[model samples]
Target: AQSVSQHNHHVILSEAASLELGCNYSYGGTVNLFWYVQYPGQHLQLLLKYFSGDPLVKGIKGFEAEFIKSKFSFNLRKPSVQWSDTAEYFCAVIYSSASKIIFGSGTRLSIRP
Candidate 1:
């Protein structure tokens, strides 16, 4: 079985500040990794994904993440964040043969404008 963990359950940031969120997964087989973000009262959207190829992947809203196979980590990063970045972020993982996914509890980011 696969599992996902997010280091922080809540993150507070100031507008225009840099942001980084840690995500890690545990699985024995090949896996698909994703970071989903939900804005205030909005639905979730894909921040990034890692299925194959390059270890480092980029996502929307100036966000990026690096997939480290050895570390089993995919950390989300943004050079600068906006007040609009305030949202709940989730880390999810799916294995090649798994029918379902494992998601982190979620990280609520509050951006102080």
Candidate 2:
């Protein structure tokens, strides 16, 4: 079965630290990748997405992800993170062959003020 994997279960960093969360999916056919962030007491929101065209897509809040077809990876990165960036990040994929979206367990990001 196709699935998404988030390498980091939990990540802790001080303010202004660079952040990189690894995400990889197992799918052979065409797929769409997305990164979602859920803040404390809030619903999940779209952070960034890669559907077509450019492999690198930028989203809200200075977050970006690269869709590497060869590696089956869509890793999220931010140059510097702030305390407000603390949230749970999820990697999701939608395979063309399937109608449902598959999501990774998610990575919890805790930023130290």
Best by lDDT: 2
Please provide TM-scores, in order, for all candidate models, with all chains considered together: 0.94, 0.98
Q: What's the residue-level lDDT of 84 in candidate 1? A: 84
Q: List the residue pairs that clash in candidate 2.
A: none
Query: Which numbered prediction scores highest in TM-score against the true structure?
Result: 2
lDDT of 2 by residue, 1-113 (tens): 89999999999999999999999999659999999999999999999888899999999999999999999999999999999999999999999999999999999999999
C-alpha displacement of 67 in model 1, angstroms?
Answer: 0.2
Measured on C-alpha atoms, candidate 2 has an lDDT of 0.95
Total residue pair clashes for candidate 2: 0
Clash counts for the predictions, in order: 0, 0
Q: What TM-score does candidate 2 reach?
A: 0.98
Off by over 4 Å in 1: none
